[model samples]
Structures are given as C-alpha cells and as structure tokens.
Target chain A: MSPVVLWVGGLMLAAAAIIIVVRIERGPSMLDRTIALDMLVGVVIAALALWSAAAERTDLVNVLVVLSLVGFVGSVTLARFVAVEPEDEGRILTPEEVRAHDGRMRASLAKESKRRVGGREDAMRRAYPESEDPR
Target chain B: MSVLDWFASICFFLGCALNLIAAIGALRFPDLLSRMHAATKPQVLGLMLVMAGLAASLGSSQLTWKLTIVVLFQFMTAPVSAHMVGRSGYRTGKVREDLLVIDELTEDLDRAKSTPIPPSSS
Candidate 1:
C-alpha cells in the first residue's frame, strides 16, 4: 500500500473511532454502551489490520486473532446480567441530582419506620385486617 | 504499483468507508436494536474486507491462513453476540415497540406465559 493510501485509511479509521466513542458516552442504556464498545473493538481491529498491511508485519496477526475471539465476551456477559432500567436510571446523574435522590429515598424510609414504630397496633391491623375484630 | 497493490489499496479504502458508515449509523439510529443493526453488519463486513486486504498485501500462505482465521471467528461470533444483546434488550423493554412491524417474540412470550406446562411422564 502507498503512503497516501495508508494515511487516508488511518484518518477514516480515526474518525470512526471518535464517533464510536461519542456513542459510547451518549448511549442511554447498558446494552447501547455494550454495542458501541463492540464496534470500538471492530474499529481497533480494522486499524490494526491497516497498520499490519502498511508495515507488512506478520507479528501483529496474532493480536488480531486474540481480539476477535475476546471481543464478544464483554457483550455476552453484559447481556446475560442486564436488567430493566428505570427511565432516568440509564443516564448518568449529576452530583446534585444524586444527592437529591438519596435524600428523597431516605425521607421515605424514615417516614415508614416512624409509622411502624409509633403505631404498632395500626400497622398490625393493616397487616392482618381480616383477623381484627369486625366491630 | 502492481495489480495486487492496487487491489489491496481499494479494499482498504472500502473497508474504512464501511466502518465510517457503521459509526454514523450507530450514532444516528433512534433505538438500541437499530444501533445494533448498524454496529454488527457493516462492522463485520468491513473487518472482513480489511482482513482480505491484509492477506492480499502480505501474499504469504501462512499469514493468509491467520487472516482467514480472524475473519472466520468474527463471522461466527458477531451474530451470536448480536442475538444475545437484542434478546436482552427486548426483554428489558429497551426496544421501541412502535417501530416493530412483526414482533413474534412478544407474542410467543405471552402465549408461553398463559399456558401451563404439562406434567412430565416418568
């Protein structure tokens, strides 16, 4: 391959890698991130192939083989364990938003505990209404 | 430049173009399944083309076999990974139902849920 061809191919591959990184950052779900990551691996493989072809290096072929085999494992493992995410949970939270959410959760938990402790008879009646006196 | 070098150069360019296209699709597609369509198909084909170009440029039987192994592994694994991701995406409600025209998997899942399994005979 000529030097010009190599340069152009390298540029294109770089652009693809950049776009894939953006997708990875902006992906709304774990699976989306996984898919972008898988594509990143493909881009890396293509870049390595281009380099090997340009340099006529046979040593790098082993790296290509290993990458191809290992790339799928990350996506497969992620898919196996990925659960349903709430609407806002998929996106990254700001520090303030995280604090607010924690506060809301803690407030609800405190209220529940207070209710249970202060009104044991009411809690029991609610839990076992049928067993309570009808009158 | 000889015919073989020209062939390799063209292959390399086309493969890079395909990678660019796949990246564009992954960025612009509306949903996860569609992005997956972008990620797997063109990406795999582009890798194969790049490998072909590599093999052509090297012009050795030994290196050619190694390149072929890389392509073969990619071919075998891409679909399996895509299927797993798509299935899990669908199960987790990441797929946009309005965009689907067929949806047999959901129908089958519902049927399976409603029907009780028969007892096994000893």
Candidate 2:
C-alpha cells in the first residue's frame, strides 16, 4: 500500500474512532454504549487491518482475531446481564439530584428492612408449621 | 502501481468509508436498535472489505489463511452478538415502540406471558 492511501485510511479511521467515542460518552443507555463500543471495536479492527496491510505484518493478524472474539464476548456478556436502568440513571446527575436520589434510596431501604423484620417470624412459621421452632 | 495494488487501494478506501458511515449512524441514530443496525451491518461489511484488501495486498498463502480466519470469525459472531444486544434492548425497554412497524416479539411475549407453560416431564 502506498503512503498516501495509508494516510487517508488512517485519517478516516481516526475520525470514525472519535465519533464512536462521542457516542460512547453521550449514549443515554447502557445498551447504546454497548453498541457504540462494539462499533469502536470494529473500527479498531479496521485500523489494525489497514496497518497490517500497509506494513505486511502477519503478526498483527492474530491480534485482529483476538479483538473480534473479545468484542463479541464483551458485548454479549453486557447485554445478557444488564438490568433495566431508570431513564435518569444513564447520564451524569447534578449534585442536588444525587442527594435527593440518595435520600430516596435510603428511605426505601429502611422501609424494606422494617418490612422484612416484621415478616420474619411469619416466614419462619410458614416454613416450619409442623414442628416447634428450634429457637 | 499494479492492478492488484489498485484493487487493494479501492477496497481499503471503500472499507474506510463504510466505517465512517457506521460511526456516523451510531452517533446519530435515535435508539438502541437503530444504532445496533448501524453498528453491525456496515461495520461487518467494511471489515470484510478491509480483510479482503489485506489479503490482496499480502498475497501470501499463510497470511491469507489468517485473514480468512478473522473474517470468518467476524461473520459468525457479529449476528449472534447483535441478536443478543437487540433482544436485551427490547426486553429492557431501550427500543422505541412507536418506531417499530410491526412488533412480533412484543406480541409473542405478551401471548407467552398470558398463557401458562406446559409442565415439563423430568
């Protein structure tokens, strides 16, 4: 490959990488981030392919294979285990919003713990109705 | 430059162009599924073209086989990952229902939820 072709391809790929990074930063959801990250991996692979072709470096080919597999595993794993996120949780929160969310979460946690404590005896009785309680 | 060099150059340029397009789509698309469409389709095709160009330029049997392996792995994994991402995105409500023309998955999920599953034989 000529140096001119190499430079043009490199510049194009760099622009793509920058755009992908912006998407990764501004994505409103985890799934969007995952998708953008996947595209970023594709761009990286293309860049590596370009470099390998330009330099006739066979060693870099293995890196391409490993990157593709790793990207697939990463995105699939994230998709598989990701939970539903609240609309507001994806972006950065203001300090006030964070404080309010923290207070709300603490209240909910306290309420849940109280409910669990109150129900523990009933739960134990239900589980061992035929026998006297060991305690 | 020889004919092979020209062919490689064209393939490389087209692949780079496709990558740029995929990036733009990923940045500009409205929702997760559309972004996924951009992320997978053009990206994979562009990768294939780049690999083809790599093979053409190298013109070595050993390195060509390695490039073929990379493309094959890409072909095999892109759809599986895309499917997983899309399914999870739909389930997690990242997809815009209004944007869909026909949502068979939603309909099927609703039906599945309403109906009782048959008891399995151990």
Candidate 3:
C-alpha cells in the first residue's frame, strides 16, 4: 500500500468516526447509542486494517479479532438487558401523537359524561312518576 | 506501484467510502431500526473490503492467516450483534413504531405471552 492511500483511508475513517461520535452523543435512546457504538467498532476495525496494511504489520490483526469479539459481546449483553424495558421508557412520542392522544381521551370522557347524564335523566323520570305523567 | 498495489488501493478507497456512508446514515436516519440497518450493512461490507486490501498488501502466509481470522470472525459476529441491538431496541421501545411498515415481532410476542406456558421437562 502506498503512503498516499494509507493517509487517505485514515482520513476517511477519521471523518466517519467523527460522525459516529455525534450520533452517540445526540442519540435519544440507549439503543441508538448502541447502534452508533457498533458502527464505531466497525470504523475502528477498518482503521486498524488500513494501518496494518500501510505499516506491513501482521501483529495488529489480532487486535482486530479481539475488538470484534468485544463489540459483539457488548451489543448482545446490552440487548438482553434492555429487552424488558417498559413500553414508555425509551420511546419519544412526537408532539402530534401527544396531541392526538389527548384529543382521544377528551372525546372518550365527554361521551362517558353524556351517557351518565342520560342515565341520570332516566332515573329522575322513574323517581318522579308525576313529572313524566304530566299528560 | 504494481497492479496488486493498485488493486489494494482501490479496495481501500472503496471501503473507506462505504464506512463514511454508514456513519452518515447512522447520524441521519430517523429511528433505531433504520440506524441499525445503516450501521451494520455498509460497515461490515466496508470492513471486509478493507481487510481484503490489507491481506493482499501483506502477502505473507502468517499475515494472510491473521487477516482471514479477522474476516471470518467479523462475518460471524456482525449480523448477530446487529440482530441483538435491533431486537433490544424494539423490545425496549427505543424504535419508532410510527416509522415501521411491519412489526411482526410485536405480534409474535403478544401471541407468545397470551399462550399458556407448557410444563417444564425438568
């Protein structure tokens, strides 16, 4: 591998790392961060491969293997641990969804009140037969 | 540079480009599943390409074996890890259901949970 190709590859991997870091930092949920971290591992592996190739070093390949192992284990453990999280814990409902939910609840409550009022009117008519038999 | 060197360079550049694409997708994607999809697919492919380039450049029996090990391990682990992450994200409600066109996992889980447990053999 030429020095120029090595440097170019390194620069590209660096740029990728920067973007992945942003995702990890800004992720709204842990799983998003996990995905970012997993990608970061991949970027690191690519960087290592580039480095080993450029330097003509075989020793670093073992490091790639170890890193891959660690990345897999970390993601699997995290996934199993988080599999039972509450429905609302990691989810972020959009504003529109929240508004729609509120509207639905209000409508249901209004309907319940109307039904209750109708029942009350029927009970009142039964309690005061004279009021209903005004004929 | 020799033809092999040129080929290696091409592979390296292609791999780096793919890595960049994966990272950008990870940042720009709207939800966890999409992000996972972006993170895993291109990244693994990129790594393989870069590793192939590295192995070709090294050209020693020992280095070839080492790179082969790395590639094999990556191929085995990448999909499993991605599956784990996506599954966990879905289970934990980290994924956006609104963005999903299909959600068979939820249906399967509901069915499983609703069914009665069988007696343990132990």
Candidate 4:
C-alpha cells in the first residue's frame, strides 16, 4: 500500500478510536460501556491490519486472530455477568412509564388523604352533634 | 497507479469510514441494545473491507490465507458476541422497554412461568 493511503487510513481509524473512547468515558450504562469497549477491540483489529500492511509484517495476522478471540470472550463474559444480575434490570424507566408511576402514587396519596378527612369529620360529628346541625 | 493499489486504497478508506460511522452510532444511540447494534453491524463490514484491502496488497499466498482465516473468525464471532451482549443487556434492564415496539422475550418468559414443567424421564 502507498504511504499516503496508509496514513489516511490510519488517521481515519484513529479518529474513530477517539469517538469510541468518548463513548466509553460517558456511556450512561455499563452495557453501553461494554459495547464501546467491544468496538474498541474491533477498531484495534483494523488498525493492526493497517499497521501490518504498512510495515510489511504478515505475522500480525496472528495477533489479529488472537485479538478477535479475546474480544469475543470478553464480551460474552460481560454479558453473562449482566444477565444474572436482575436487580439492575429495570433501572431505566421510560418517560411515559415514569409519568404513569408518578400519577399512580399521587392518586394513592389523594385517596388516603380523603379517607383521613372523612374519618375526622365523622369523629367531629359524633363528638359534638350540635356542631353538625344546619344553622 | 496500478489498478490493485486503487482498489486497496478505496476499500481501506471506505472501511475506515464505516468504523467512524459505527463509533458515532455507539456514542449517540439512546440505549444499550441500539448501541450494540450500532457497534457490531457496521464493524463486521468494516473489518472485512479493511482486511480485503490489506490482502489485496500482499504478494504471498500464505499471507492471503492468513487474512482469510482472520476474516472467517471475525464473521463467526461477531454476531455471537453481539447476540450475547444484547440478551444480557435486555435481561439486566439496560434496555428501555418502552422504546421497544415488540417484546417477545417478556411474553415468552411470562408463558414459561405460568406453565408447569413436565416430569423428566431421567
């Protein structure tokens, strides 16, 4: 490959790597981070291919194989870890679900308050019958 | 420039571009499953393109065979890994259910839990 092509490919791949790193740094969830890391390994493989092509070292193909294997294992392990942890599931609620939950809580609170107020009025009427008489 | 060099250069650049796009998708996607989809789908194509570019430039038969093995290995593993990650993400609640238009897994789990298991012959 020409030096110009190699340099351009390398630069593009490097830029891609930077974007993936940003994702890893700021991903909102652990799974998102894991996905980013998996992509990093992929980008690394491409970079390694570019390097081997530029450097005329075919043995890096072996490294590429190993990296792919390692990446698969890592992703599978992370997935397994996340799968078994049920408590973490449902950590993110959608806007509609959140709103509905909030509404349900408010309604329950209102019902409880209404019950309390009605009981208090009943007690007052029983304690002072004349107070309840219409003036 | 030779035809081979042009082909190699074009494939290499396109592959790199795909990688960049995949990265953008991974970063900007709203949830884990979408991010996983973004990270894996284009990445396989990118890897193939990049490898094809490199293999085109190599002179020896041995190096070309090695590249073939790498591509095969990548294709075999990428989907399996992505599937595992998506399943785990779904199970662990990394996915936002409200965003999903259809939830087959939840329905399956519900049906399984509601039914009684048959006695094993063993």
Candidate 5:
C-alpha cells in the first residue's frame, strides 16, 4: 500500500539473494551448489509472490506454480543422480592401483586448476598489461 | 491491509525466515543427512506458509483455491523428494554418519536387496 512496504520487501529479497550467492561461492560440491541454487529459486518465487500481490494480478500465481513444478522436477532428477550407486565401497582394487588412480586424479585436478588460472591471467594481461595477475 | 492480513504476512515472513535458517543449517552442518533434513523440514513448511499467506491476502475464491492446490501438492511431494534423495545418497555412499542421530535406513538396505527391490519398480 506504500513505498515503505515495497522497499522493505525488496530489501528482504535482496538479502535472501545475497545468502544464495554466498552459498554458491563457498559450496564444497556440485550437490551443495545445486541445493543452494534451489534455495535461490525459492527466494525468487517469494519475491515474485510479493510483486504479484503489489500488482494485484492473480495470473502470475499460475506461472509461479509452473516454475516451481519445473524446478522441483529438475532438482529431484539431480538428487536421484546423486543417490544412485551400487551399495558397496569395498572394491578389491590393489593398493598400487588405488595409489595410481589417486595420483592421476590429483594430477588432472591440478592441471585443470592451472589451466583455469592461466586463461584468466591471459585475459587480464590483454585487458591491462600493467595490472598484476589476480589469480 | 487489514490486521488479519498483517498477521498472515508476519506468519509467512516467519516461515520464510525459518526456511532460510534451514538452508543455513544445511550449509553449516557437517554431513549430508543433516543437510538434507535442514533443506527439507523448514523449507516445506515455509513454502506452505507463503502459499497460505498469499491465499489469505488475495480475496479471490478462485485464486485461493489454486493456492490451496499448490500448497497441497508441495506438501505432499517435498518429503517424497527428500526421502528419495536421502535414500539415493545412502545407497551411493554419500552418507556421512558422524552427524546423524539415527540410521533407520540401515536395515532397509539389506531388506531392499533381499527383496530385490529395483528402482521405481515398486
């Protein structure tokens, strides 16, 4: 009914968005990121609801329902994928095999990290030659 | 807005804030099961409150009915989804038990295998 309400709602939604952003930045795994993003979507839906209330239109509620359904379905699929694995962790690989596999995985991750940093530095250097690389 | 409307909005705000708190708990918790719980319990109820508040404030019979449906469907499905995710994570060795208070699903796995329970086959 007033500008104050609008401002307050917007600020609340912004705060929620900031939480989602922080979660995205610090999430330790893909699933964690996905969950955080799902929370972000929920915040968006809440914001949408408030806007629809402000505008006095009911049509958007249907859109909200549709968006929520789609989000839920997509998230459930991801959760399922995360959930599915054969029920044993005690495979009979030899110690040497395990060590070799671990070594390869670490090497690949390191290479990929380096490649990412290198790409960033190249772009930054092209943008400003005098700037120190942030990576 | 009426005092009733304000009350509804405050309830909704509280629910949403709790849901956000749940998300924070999920993030700060040390294990997957606790996180799954934090994501599920508060959020499902929180969204229900949001739907309820909207329904109350709308003043339209049609809109209210639809909002009821949304709340109902979300209430029904949220737990099913959470359970599936938890079960799948457990099956795949994604479980972290150090933070868990119980393991009701521990026996379920053996029973599931003994009965040859295939995914989505039931």
Candidate 6:
C-alpha cells in the first residue's frame, strides 16, 4: 500500500514538474528560468524521500541529505550570478526604460520568430507529396 | 490490501497531489521571488506526508528514524537555499520592480554595498 501511494505521488509530482519546465522554456529572462530550476530540485528531494519510505529503505536517506546541501549551493551560485538591484532609492527600473528595452528585444525576436515559422513551412512542403496542399 | 497498505496509499496520493500544486504555483506565478515562495512551502508539506506514509508501510523504527532525519534536514535547509537564491538574484540584477513585495534586501545591499568582496578571494 505504501509503495502504491509513493508511485502515485511521484507521478503527480512529475506531471507538475513538466509544467514548470514549460515555464522555464518560455521564460523571458535568465532569472525566471533560475527560479524554475530551484523548484525542480525541491521536487526531486520530495520524491526521493517518498520513495525511500515506501521501499522500507533507510539506505536512501543519504541521497536526500546530499541533495539538500547541493541544491542550496546551486541556488546560491545562480543568485550571485543573477543579482539585481534592491527595489529602492529610485534605482529600480521605471516603466519607460522597461518599455524601451522590451521593444528593442521584441523587434529582434519578431524577426527571428518569422524566420523560424517560414523555415518550418518550407520543410513541411518538401516532406509532403506533390499532391498534398502546401497550405 | 491490508488496512496499513490502504491508508498509506491514500496519504501518498494526497502528498503527490499537493506537490504538483506547489510546482504549478511556482510556474504560474508572474515573478521569480513569488515563484520561490510557491516552490518551497507546499513541497516540504508534501514530502512530510510522503515520509509518514513510507514509515507506515515499512513499519521499522530504525528506518522511520532515518526517514525522519532526512525530512528534518530538508525542512531546515530549504529556507537557507531560498535566501541564497534571493540574495544572488538581487546581486545579479533580476529583481522585477512591478511585482515585488517587501524591500528588506535593499537595506541589506545598502549596508554591504560599500564593502567590496573580490571575486577571486573566494
């Protein structure tokens, strides 16, 4: 019964993690992706503990302990690398700057997006038979 | 299935569901810091539930004690990890002004802003 519960629980967590991965993939910036990575490690530890208990295996405890330490180290490294200004003293971004920067990136990204879509269509046309509509 | 098995399985399912909710919260939230809060809390609770279910199924004092050790350490350390990540996120310039809550870290940065730590020193 315990093992069954663990298996179900792990599967549920996995599904949730996949959703997080999507966010990571779609993140507009590096920091957004970093948070997702942090969450992923947390999920891993939880799943491990559940499995260890379900299996009646005390031997797996070490894995959780090691991961706990390792996850913190990894987060610290990322946070340090991605440090932001504290939101005070008028130093944080104003609306205009954000708009300007986003506009520039969007312009570039739009061109890329269009090019990729065009390429996909071209590939599709080549893969299909002549009788198939290119549309 | 035995009574013990049935109870454990149900609890395990509940824990898994809670964990998934936490992950969804982490992803669906608009900003990174908010996402961290969502990421940490529910996962710990979910893990606690999972460990308890494991103990029930295994039915060994020694194993239960070990499982408890892992859970205890995880709970204690998760906050530290969050803090480090938040600190680093701030240092590297990832703080989003549009969705921020408290500004305690700003004070921290101000206090330490004057003191320069050479990267190579570490």
Better of 2 and 6 by lDDT: 2
Put down candidate 5 lDDT per residue, B1-122, tens digits, no spaces: 68857855665566557656765676677666666666765456767777766776677888988877766666666666666666666666666767567777776656776885544535
> In candidate 1 chain B, what residue range of length 10 has the lowest lDDT sum?
B113-122
Where is model 3 more than 4 Å wrong at Cα?
A83-135, B111-122
DockQ each: 0.63, 0.62, 0.51, 0.47, 0.22, 0.41
RMSD (CA, Å), each prediction = 9.3, 7.3, 14.7, 13.9, 12.2, 11.9
What TM-score would candidate 1 get against the native?
A: 0.82
What are the per-residue Cα lDDT tens digits for candidate 2 across A1-135?
998889999999999999999998897998888888888888889899899988888899899989877778888999999899988789868899989999999999999999997799778888888878624
DockQ of 1: 0.63
Model 4, residue B30: distance off in Å is 0.6
The residue pairs in collision within model 1 are none
Residue B59 lDDT (model 5) = 71
True contacts kept of each: 0.84, 0.83, 0.87, 0.77, 0.20, 0.76
Q: Write the per-residue lDDT of candidate 6 for residues A28-94, one digit (tens) a residue.
A: 4565676677777767766776766656566776786677656666666665666343444323357
Query: Per-residue lDDT for A23-131 in model 3, tens only?
Result: 8878677777777888888888888888888887778888987987677888787777865555454555689998999999999999999999888888888888777
Candidate number of the best TM-score: 1
TM-score versus the correct structure, for each prediction: 0.82, 0.81, 0.74, 0.75, 0.67, 0.64
Q: Candidate 2 or 3, higher lDDT?
A: 2
Residue ranges of candidate 1 with Cα displaced over 4 Å = A95-135, B118-122
Each prediction's whole-model lDDT (CA): 0.89, 0.86, 0.81, 0.80, 0.67, 0.71
Better of 5 and 6 by DockQ: 6
* lDDT string, candidate 4, A9-107, tens digits: 888889889999888777566677777888888889889888888888888888987887667888778777764444434256679988999999999
TM-score quality measure for candidate 2: 0.81
Tell me the deviation in Å of residue A25 in model 1: 1.1
Candidate that scores best on lDDT: 1
How many steric overlaps are in each model, in order?
0, 0, 0, 1, 1, 13
Query: Model 2 Cα displacement at A70 (Å)?
Result: 2.2
Residue ranges of candidate 2 with Cα displaced over 4 Å:
A93-135, B116-122
Order of the predicted models by lDDT, top scorer first = 1, 2, 3, 4, 6, 5
Worst 10 residues of 2 chain B by lDDT: B113-122
Residue B68 of model 6: what lDDT? 84
